[model samples]
Target chain A: MNGLDPGPLLFFVFGWFFALNIKGITDRTYRQASRFVPMIGGSVTLRIMGWIWIFVGGTLLALDFLG
Target chain B: MGAGWGGGGIGYSITLAETQTPDGKTQIGILTSKSVHSAGADFGLSATAGKFYSNADDIGQLEGKGLDKGGSAKFGLGLYGNHQTEVGTTNSKGEGVNVIEYGLGAGLGAEIGGGYSDAKSRWQTEIGSDKK
Candidate 1:
C-alpha cells in the first residue's frame, strides 16, 4: 500500500496466470495435433506466443520484486 | 499440438509475429501453411525469423551501431481449402454414393501488443555519461 500499488500487483499476477494457462493449453494442443494430424502445426506458433507472454509476465513480476 | 476432426475437410493458415527488444530494436517472423486439409489425414508447417540491431565499435562508433528498444505487434491469418466425400444409403438393389460439397476460404486477423522495460538501464547510462 505504501511503495507499490495493489492495482499493478494484481494485474501482474493475473497476467502471469493467464500466460501459464495459455502455455499449457498450447503445449497440449501442439502435442496432440503433431501426433495424429502430421500436417497440422497448431502447437508451434501458439506455443511460441505463449512462451513470449510467460517471459514478459515473468519479467514484470521480477521488476516488481526489485522495486 | 491442436487436434480436431470434422468429417473430411482441408484448411490453411498464416501467422506473423513482431517483437521489440529492450534496446528499441524490432524483430519479425512469418509463418505460412501449405497443405492444411486432407481426406482422412492432416498436415502443418512452422517457420520463424528473428533480427536485432548491431553497431560497430571504434570507427563504427562514430557511424553509430547499437541496439535500440522499440515496440511491435503481431498479426495472423488462416486460409482453408477442403474436399469431402461421403456414402449414402442404396435404394433397392441399386448402389448409391454421395459426393460431399467442399470448398476453400481465407481468414484474416490482426492484434496489437507491446511491452515496456524498466528505464533504469537508460537512466544509469545517462547519469554515468553526464557531462556536468
Candidate 2:
C-alpha cells in the first residue's frame, strides 16, 4: 500500500463523470469552454470525455510507476 | 442479443454458475441468436469439443431502450433467454441449468455486472438506458 492510491480516486472521478454525463453538464461545459467539437448530447459528448479521462488516468498511472 | 416489452420495458440480471465438477473436464461450444421484439430463438451445435451435432435451437429476444427519464433518473432493464441441446463439445452432463440475474446501471454508464456459469445452463440480464 503506497498510502492513498490514486487508482480509486480515478474510479471515483469516473463515477462523477457518469453523473455529469447523465446530467449533461460536462459536455455543455466543455463545449462552452473549449473549441473541441460542437455541443452534442450527453450520450455522445460525455462518452468522448470518458475516453479522455481514461487516457489521462493511464498516463498518470504510468508516471507514478516510473517515478 | 434480446428484446423485451413490459411496463415500458426494463429489469436486471444476475447469473450464478458453478464449475464443471466430476471429471474436471471442460468443453467449449458456439452460440448464435436473432431476436425481433423480445422473442426469438438460437440454433447451434456442440459435442464435447470433439464431436459436432447439428440442429439445436431455442427461444430468445432482443432488448433495447433510449434515455428513459423516470423522476429525473434515467434507467431501464432488458432480459432474454435461449433453449439448448447437447451439441458441439460441451461435456458437462445433466439437464441444462436455469438462472436469473439483475443489474443496475446508474449515472452515465456506470454498469456493474455479476453472474454465474455452470456446466449445463445459461441466462442473462442487463440494466441501463440511453436517453440521448
Candidate 3:
C-alpha cells in the first residue's frame, strides 16, 4: 500500500467527471467563468477538458504499471 | 483562447476556450487593473473586456496579484470566449519574492506547479479563485 501513487487514478476520475459533462460541474464552471470569458462557460469546452484528462491519466497508468 | 509559459516559482498549463460570447457576439476591448501595494493589506482588480454576446469583435483578459510583508494585489483578464493569464505571490518577511503562472485555452484543463520558500521546496496545484 505504501508504494501506491494516486496521481494517475485521481486524474482518471477527474477526466470521467469532465467527459460526462455532469451538470453540477458544468453549472459551477459556467457560472464562475462566464463572468470573464462567457464563451468558455459552455459544456463543449468542459467535455474536451475531461477527455484530455482521461487520456493523460490512462497514459500515466500504463506507464506506472508497464514501465 | 491562448497559450503561454514562464518560470518564476515554476508553472505550466494548457487551456482552450470559446471564441465568441455565449450569445455569439464578437467583442473587442482592453481590460486592465489598478495596482496597489501596502504592508499587511490585500488588494485586487477584475474586469471583462468586450461587448458580451451582443456585439462584434474579439474578447480576452489579463489578471494577477501579489503580497509584500503585509500587502497583496490581484488582477485578471479574458477575451475570445476569453484567453486569461494570472499570477500571485506573497513575501511575509519583506524579502524578495518570485511567482509566475501562465494558462492557455478558452477553458480550464491541467497545470503543473511548485514553489520554493523558507529554505524548502514544495509542489502544489495552481492557486487562486474566480470571483463569485
Interface RMSD of each: 10.4, 15.2, 8.4
Report the number of clashing residue pairs per model: 18, 34, 32
The Cα local distance difference test for each model comes to 0.28, 0.28, 0.33
Over 4 Å off, model 2: A1-67, B1-21, B24-91, B107-132
Model 2 reproduces a share of the real contacts of 0.00
Give the docking tier of candidate 3.
incorrect
- Candidate 2 chain B weakest ten by summed lDDT: B40-49
Cα lDDT tens digits for candidate 1, A1-67: 6654333344344334333654475455455544543433334454454344444334444655775
Model 1: CAPRI class: incorrect
Q: How far is candidate 1 from the true structure (C-alpha RMSD, Å)?
A: 21.9
lDDT of candidate 1 at residue B123, scale 0 to 100: 8
What are the per-model DockQ values?
0.02, 0.04, 0.08
Superposition error at B62 for model 2 (Å): 17
**Cα lDDT, model 2, residue B23:** 41
Candidate 3 on B90-115: residue-level lDDT in tens? Answer: 22333333322232233432222222
lDDT of 2 by residue, A22-64 (tens): 5665555445433533322434444543544444444444545
